[model samples]
Target: MRVLTGVMLCVLLGALDQTVVIPAVPAIAADLNGFGHLSWIVTAYLLTSVSCTPIYGKLSDIYGRRALLLPAIVLFVAASGLCGMAQDLGQLIVFRALQGMGGGGLMAMAQASIADVIAPRERGRYQAYLSGMWGIASVAGPVLGGLLVDHLSWRWIFWINLPLGIAALILSNRALRNLTVHRREVRIDYPGAVLMAGCVTASLLVMSWGGSSYPWASVQILGLSAVALGLLVALVAQERRSIEPLLPPRLFGHSVFTSAVSIAFLASAAMLGATFLLPLYFQLAHGVDAATSGTLLVPFLLASVAGAYASGQAARRFGRLKYVVLTGLAVATTGFALLTLLAASAGPVAIAALMVLMGAGLGTCMPSSLVIGQNAAERRDIGTATGALLLLRAMGGAFGSALAGAVLALSFGAALTQAGHAAGIDPGLLRTGFRAGFLACTVVSAAGLLVALLMRDLPLRSGN
Candidate 1:
């Protein structure tokens, strides 16, 4: 119980910052006079966090979860302080990237640590706690950030992490004391880690800048894409030749690990795409204010938490994980299909109901996939396997958001002037764009369903 509580705090610490900084973005930009580079404040954290997750996982496998987790918490807290005291936008961006180094470990290590203490068969119910923390952070972050920025300062958003990080650090240290550390004295794969980080950074930069900062077909985007590809090839070669690869290629040979991560990737893409667009749909199509639209999102967020808890409980009780995942994806796909049919005049109740359906459906799959991945991997590779699953999941979300943004731009382009200002876009056009986005999510969800169908349902391990 202490371990679970400790990790949930860690999860909250990591997840909260992701959403909290969003509301502060405008404030931070204004104060620092960096509207041009505002996106980097968020993009920098995401890039580092996602790239470092696998590294944390692999290292924890060698050094143990507690060893990595303690340092990560300290780093996160220290970086948060630095972020609060940033003298310029560049400083904040650098600190945010540093914070992400720790944030990535917080998440990956939490998942791996849970696997260390709990049996795979029973891990789902506990995972529900972490999922709930994410839902809470997602819902509360913007609101808390808004209040802090309005009354106090945008820096408070970062400063607020201090207390939370301290609590998590103290608790994790005590709770994880008993966790077995099977340290392996092997040389760290610096070359492979560097190549992997470079590849992910380049690829993510392309994703972040493609439509917003540079045209997709521009030299900058193409150059980054080529760099990412070359680095990926080098990474593959390095991993294959290395004695102890950072990400062992053998993990993919396990049908369970491959299928689990693939399904997670697709499901995350669909879920995140819809999530990114739903508020806009409410604001544009239903003509609600930002606050009201946020209010409307509450049902979806709560339903997601409920769904995760229910599925976890069911998985623990019934012991068949695949069916739970399949059913959830089917429901989510159906919700997305229905969402595409929503008219511009769709009522708040109707939209909220659909959100609930989709939220619940996708939520069911999130934690179950993690358990499935860990269950399939060799015991020693649990951290690595978890890291891989999360890495793909993050990539999927980034892709989904990008896809949704591109779809929305199609309508915005037709409605707006050459200056790229939104001069009161027609509601009909807005609905068209939103519907197209929902349709895209439907396809993504259907893909997840298909992957789930093909996945082999490995029996959950009775012991870790």
Candidate 2:
């Protein structure tokens, strides 16, 4: 209980940061007079956090989880404080990047710490705890941020993390004291780490800037794409030859690890891509406000939490995960397919219900995939494996959201050109674009289902 509490606090810190800052973006821009660079406030955090995850995991495996986690918490808290005190957008963006370095460690170490104590068979239940934390963060973050911004100030969003982070640091320190540490003396692969970070940053930049900031075929985007690809090739080569790779190349040899990571990438892409679109769908198609759309998303989020809990219990009872994940991917695929055919006349309640089904299906597969990856890895490689799965998941989500956005842009561009004004744009045209996005989601989910089907079910370990 103590350990779970500690880790959940760590998870909360990371999750809340992602959601809370969104509401404060407008206030942040106005206060700093930097509307043009506002996206960087979030993008900076994302780029660093996602890029550093595997490095943190690898280090935690070499050092102790406790050793890395304490510093991560401290750094996150310190960065949060700096974020609150920033006077300009540049300062805020830099602090946010610093915060991401720690935030990534918080997430990676939390799950890796859980693996240190819990067997793969029992890990599912704990994953539910993590899922619940995320659900709470998702629901409460914007609301809390709004309240803080409206009542006090935008800076409060960052200041708010101080008390919570300190508490988490305290609890985690006490709980993790007894965690066994096996310090490895392997040479650190500095080049590989640098190469991996460069690759991820370049890739994410392409996703973030393409179509939105620049044309997909623009010189800038092409340059970024080439850099990303080149870095990736160099990274693979470095990993293959290095004495101690940042991400061990050998982990990919395990069928379970390979399959789980691939499924994670595809499933996460579909899930997060749809999540990104749904709120816009509500506002544009249903003529609802942002707050109401958030409210409407509650059922979907809650159902996801419930699905994760149910799936965890099922795994505990059945001592199996493959069929459970298969069922989930299948359900999500169906939900996305149906969404492609949905009409605006279907009403908010119907949309919410469909979201529920999709969320639940996606949530159900999440814990099982993590368990599968961990179970397939050698004991020492658990952290490495966990890191790899999460890395792919994040990358997949970026790709999926980008893909959906591209589809929407293509479909909506013609309508916008014809309408000649934002107010004159038809809801039916928006629906068409959204449907195209949903169709893309359906294809991604179906591909995930196919991967799940092809994956071999390894027996869950009864002991660590």
Candidate 3:
């Protein structure tokens, strides 16, 4: 329990950081007088976090979770302090990137530590706890950010992490004292790590810049895509020959691992894509305010927690997860398909119910996928495997949001054109656009359902 509590504190810090700063963005920009580069405050963190995830995982496998986790906690705390004290947006962005470097390891280490202490058969319940933490953060973060910005200062958003982080650091130090360290003589795969980081960084930049800051076919986007592809190819080749590969090529050979990764990727894409569209649907179609829309999302967030807990119990009882995840995807796909039929006249209660279904499906599939992926991986590669899954999920979220945004933009434009107005708000036109966006979500969910069906049921390992 002590260890779990310590790790959860770390998880909370990381999860809260991702969202708790969002509401404070405008305030931060105004104070720093850097409104033009406001988005970089968030984008920098995400880019670094994604790029560093796999590197941390591989290093932890070499040095041990406790060794790496301690430094990560310290870095995160220090970065938070710097972020809180930043005199300008440039300093804040740099500090935020540093924070991401630490945040990336928090989840990977927490999950890996749980695997180290618990048998695979029993890990589901604990994984559910992590999912619940994320859900709570998702809901509480924006609220806390808003409260801090309104009642206090935007700096408090970053300052709030200090006490929690210090406590977590002390607890983790004591709790992880007995962890076995795996000392090996193999050389670190520095080349592969650098190449992999480059590949991920370039890919993320493309995703962030495409259709927003630059056209998809512009030289900037195209050049980044080409560099990303080249780096990926080089990384793969280097991994094949390296004595200590960052991400072993052998992991991909296992159908279960590959399938589980795909499920996580697709499930995240579908969930985020749907989430991106839902608020617009409420605000534009039904004329709801931002605060009320946020309030209405509570059902979706809470339902995810419920679904995660229930799925964990089910996994423990049945000693299987494939069917559980499959059932989740089925429900999610159905929920999204139903959402395509939503109209401007739909009641709040009806929308809330659909959100519940979608959230539950996502919650069920997420933890189950982690359980299955860990089960499928070799004992020595647990950290790398977990990290890779998370990295893919992060990328999937970016893709999903960008794709959904594109679809909404095009569909809204077409609908507005048909309505004979390009600038005025039209409920009917907004509804039409929302239908198209929901249909895109339905398609993404359906794709995940198909991927879930391909996952093979692997028996959970009884011992670590």
Candidate 4:
């Protein structure tokens, strides 16, 4: 229980840190003086996280989970201090990147550790605790972040991590004394890491800048795309010959691996898209404050916890994961279908109900899909397997966020243009854009349903 508590603390910090600063961003920007670089503050961390999650997973397999995880906690603490003491936005952004290395380690290492300590049959209950931690963070981050900024200084947002991190570090050091390490003689694939990072960064750059900074077809975007593609090509060629590859090339051949990963990516895409949209809808369409809009996510977060617990247990017991995840995807899509039917003046109750279904579906599908992916791989390859799963999930989420952002932000004020005189929203442009965002989210959710269909039956772990 001590180890569990320690790891969950790490997990919660990772979850909370991801969005805790979001509400404080405006204030930070005011002091830092780089409004143009606002996106980089978020993007730098995300890109680093997406790039490193898989690497951490792989390294944990070679080194020990505790060894990697402990340092990660320390690194996060140091970076948080750096963020709090930042003299400029650029310095803050750099520290955030350092912070993401820790975040990646926290999330994937904690997950892999859970599979280590708890038998798969009994793991659902523990997984539920971690999932609930996320629920609490999702509900708490914006409100806490807003209050800290309003009452204290924006620096408090970063400062908060100091105590939580130190506590996590001390607990981990005390409780994780018996962690078994299996040092294997495997060479680190530095080139593969660089190539993978380059590809992810390029893709993220396109998404972040495509619609706003320049058109999708512009030279800037196209040039970046070509670089990403070239690196990916080189990465594959390098891996085909390397003694140790970042990904198991055989994954491309295995039906279960390929299919499950696809489903995971699609599921990630849908959930991320919805998360982005709902917040926009809450703030823009309903004229809610950022803090209140964050509050409106309560139903989705709670439902997600319920679904993860129920589905994880079912998967553990049933050994029929494909269907379990598919059912989740189907139900989530149905919720989106219902949202499509929502009138511009739809009640809060209606939207809340639909979000519950969406969140539940995602919760049901994602954890099970991860289990399937991890289960299919050889035990020796658990690190690589975990990395592969995370890489796809991150990529999918990035794509989803970008796609939704583009669809929502691009239309700007087309709602007023279409309706002649505004009938539903007083904010006009902001409200209309958010509505379009939700509508785009519905389309993405429907796409996830199709991906879920491709998932093949795989035995869930009874005792991995």
**What C-alpha RMSD separates each model from the true structure?**
1.3, 1.2, 2.1, 2.8
* Best-fitting candidate, scored by lDDT: 1
Error of 2 at 452 (Å): 0.3
State the lDDT of candidate 1 residue by residue for 165-271, as single tens digits.
99999999999999889988998889999999999999888888887788789999999999999999999999999999999999988888899999889888887
lDDT by residue for model 2 (32-147), tens: 99999888998899999999899888888899888989999999999999999999999999999999999998998898889999988898999999989999998999999999
Candidate 1 has its poorest 10 consecutive residues by lDDT at 414-423
Tens-digit lDDT track for model 3 on 220-280? 9999999999999999999999998999988878899998888888888887887677776
In model 2, which regions exceed 4 Å deviation?
Answer: 414-422
lDDT per prediction?
Answer: 0.90, 0.89, 0.86, 0.79
Error of 2 at 136 (Å): 0.5
Model 1 TM-score, all chains together: 0.98
After the best TM-score superposition of candidate 4, give how far the Cα of residue 197 lies from its true spot, in angstroms. Answer: 0.9
Off by over 4 Å in 3: 413-423
Q: Which residue pairs show collisions in model 1?
A: none
